[model samples]
Target chain A: MDGDTRETIREVAIDLFSTRGFDQTSLREIAERVGLTKASLYYHYPSKQALLTAIVSPLLDGWRAVTDEAEGMAHTPDNVRHVLTTLLDVMVVNRPLASVLLRDPAGVVAAAGPLWQDMIDVATRLTNWVAGPEPTVAQRLRAIAAMEVLRAAYSSITYLREEVADAEMREVLLDSALGALRR
Target chain B: MDGDTRETIREVAIDLFSTRGFDQTSLREIAERVGLTKASLYYHYPSKQALLTAIVSPLLDGWRAVTDEAEGMAHTPDNVRHVLTTLLDVMVVNRPLASVLLRDPAGVVAAAGPLWQDMIDVATRLTNWVAGPEPTVAQRLRAIAAMEVLRAAYSSITYLREEVADAEMREVLLDSALGALRR
Candidate 1:
């Protein structure tokens, strides 16, 4: 019962936080949405910050898993493709959470410092792999552009509401990303 | 004196508003930055909204110019190259204001409404041009990816602080945008 209530709180909080700015949302709102009292919500999550942490914790774990896997592989094109394909999978699955996180202030997330650091570190690592060492301006921009495009494409799915299925969109995004990288 | 003061206010407002979110900035801060009294700031622009309007009006005009030029031409590859090249120039020149405008909520600028309408109309026209009469999902996503990359690249100039000259970067961006469009 305790765990179930906590899950309910987490779902409602994410919904409300997406529609309303994180700062504007209150525990009271989450409580109302979850049919729990503020005191109960407090018992489950001490603060909105804590609730956000709990929601993103899974995403962090997934990200760590991908990076850890990448660490074992050689930096070949095949490895690069695998890294991006796996990243695309993670992003597509977490589309709702990604949209919210993208819109929210970096400062807000940075307060949970280690998670923020990991994010920057991962982004830098991916760009490095794409650009290799001593990259020129064009090489750096191309890498950033391709990665950003993939993220945008995944995020677009929620709003685009296209008839195209996820699998096809996945292929389109991956192919486009690879093209952008090679171009 | 009036025009000069207005220019000063507009510039300062963009800087402060970019550093602080639109909702977070005060008219007093703009006045202080411009070295004006609140009364004088109000005299030039009725509200912070009006200040934003003044700052972006020129950008809107410039955008309108690019789009207007694009409208008269055929949506061929050569035409697309010309259009993006012109837009890249406009974006790089108005880079600071463009960065702030992109970051701020559409509603903040939408109050006056015509500018907002123009914004939507122009984006639609550009996307339509890129996507053709009936675009496939891949085509649409690729077009969006290219445009976003160009914007990100331009916005990055300030942060990148790279020794690369603007003209060379322009060519690089142009080549990249064209490549993305083709892909």
Candidate 2:
């Protein structure tokens, strides 16, 4: 029951923060929507920032897991594709949270320092993997290029939601990213 | 003198909107900063939204210019680089306005419909340019992937400001973007 309430609060907060800008949302509104009294909500999360922290925790964990899996794989073209595809899958699946992170990352970084750092750490590792050993300046640039491409596609939900089918978009983006690395 | 006030108002408003956000800025504040009375400001831009429209006008012009230039070019790899490089130059030179456009595009779009349409038209032209006539599924996907990559890098002042020299980031990003488009 305790866990259920906590999860409920987290889910509601994610929806609110994703749709309305984070700064615009309030604790009372979150509690009201969750069907919990203010006192009960406070028991789960002492403040709105705390609730946001709880909400974004899973996303960070998922990113860590994907990067870890990628790190363990061979750095071949096939392995690179797998890693890129998994990253895209995680991105598309968590579209709302991903959108929030990409659109207003500064606010999220301010509120949750460690999580943001972890995300950058993961990005650096992925870049290293793409560059491999003895990377040229150009290769480093490509890695940055590849990251932006994937991030933009996933972050712009309005664009993706309208034009590309989810599965197909993932495949194409991943393949194109891998293709860039090949040359 | 009349044209100068309009330009000054537009510039001040963009700076305020970029730093303090759209909701936090007021027409009076902009007028004061520009050493004009609120009435004078009103004579130039009747509302905050109109001020925003004026700020975004050049961006829309640049977007249209890039697309128009690309349409005239042959759909070859070198032409792709030239068109994209020119587009990146415009974006980098107008970094603050570009940032505002990326951050709260919906607000800008709502206030200025033509501005939003211009962006979409450019993006469509970009995709078409990369894909060319009789494009395969993979080619279409590649175009979107390339576009996203460039958008992400150019839009991110935080990353671009740090990663490359201010004068040279545009050139570097353009090279990287064109590289992504190459087969």
Candidate 3:
């Protein structure tokens, strides 16, 4: 249960989950790959779901942090730009984590109430950022539109991997998303 | 293999594909749901992959049409807005079809050679549109960003479903996506 062992387990779990899918991957396979006995692995994370949850906690934290920051920002194009830039940076930096969030099992989201709540919280913050303070109905609609676009672009890494550098892509994506928010 | 029956079969296949996934659903299930015998289904579509390709054809055509229109227009914000607005309208009107295009199996993009080619052709046209008649690096980046945001917003029906009506949603999404191309 040292930091290194925990990190190792999380990384292996991400790979297996992404490749084989969340339901198909097993805790035993993850433990064997990490060179840990079942008892030793269980000491760190008691269940498979717990291990999966741990792997995605950082993404949840990052999403929450961005949304929280946007909540306090003044409603202006500049502020909207800053929020979107930050959000895209986090997504690009945590591409694998973001992928997991996008591909979360429908069953898991249904069963895990908190996970769905967190998603709503993050989405609300994103929409609010685009709408700004005291937004018109049109602005709110625009915000929803912007959020959808950003989600699609960021979720598809295969598209990203082929076209441009990650940093450049991030800048472009944020620029487009924020532009959509502006009047 | 009348047009109406062919269209009906495609519609049923899209619903089933989205819900049960491609592999899990079979030709028999589709035929049963559509009230067509397997022989009749085969007359219209030789195989499951053929059925999928037929469903995706309209989406690819729409992409091409938009890209062509954008290419011919002046690269002003107004023109950009017009092109995207038109694209979104078509996309929204054909939501079920667009969803199938977006949700195709990843491996099929390679194995289904014609489908993949059509996608590339459409993407190339889009990139060219953003690049404008003679695009600067920043303009090219803006184009890429605009395309990414537009595609993302159009594909995501689950998140913003409540906020905007289907028709209005298309307008809102297009406006925001075009916002990136504006100065």
Which predicted model would earn the best TM-score? 1
Question: Is 1 or 3 the stronger prediction by DockQ?
Answer: 1
Model 3, A18: alpha-carbon shift in Å? 5.6
**Model 3, A1-183: lDDT tens per residue?**
456888898898788766544544567788799998777888878777687678777777888988888888777767777877787777777777656544434324433458767877677767766676776666776676566546545444543334567766676567666677666
Report the error of model 2 at residue A52, Å: 2.7
Q: What does TM-score give for chain A of every model?
A: 0.87, 0.85, 0.83
Error of 1 at B146 (Å): 1.4
Better of 2 and 3 by TM-score: 2
Off by over 4 Å in 3: A1-54, A72-82, A100-121, A133-135, A148-172, B1-6, B19-45, B68-82, B103-114, B133-137, B152-156, B161-167
Clash pairs detected, candidate 3: A149-B153
**Model 1 stretches astray by more than 4 angstroms:** A1-3, A23-43, A106-118, A154-161, B1-3, B36-40, B102-118, B154-163
Docking class of 2: acceptable
The per-candidate TM-score of the B chain, in the order shown, comes to: 0.88, 0.82, 0.80
Candidate 3 local lDDT, B21-104, one digit each (tens): 444467899999999887889998888788877777787888888888887788776776677777766766677665554443
> How well docked is model 3, in DockQ terms?
0.26
In candidate 1, residue A90 scores what lDDT? 88
Q: Residue by residue across A49-129, what tens digits does model 2's lDDT show?
A: 787777777777777888888778877877877777888887878877765664444456556668678777776776777
Q: Rank the candidates by DockQ, best first.
A: 1, 2, 3
Task: Return the number of clashes found in candidate 2.
Answer: 0
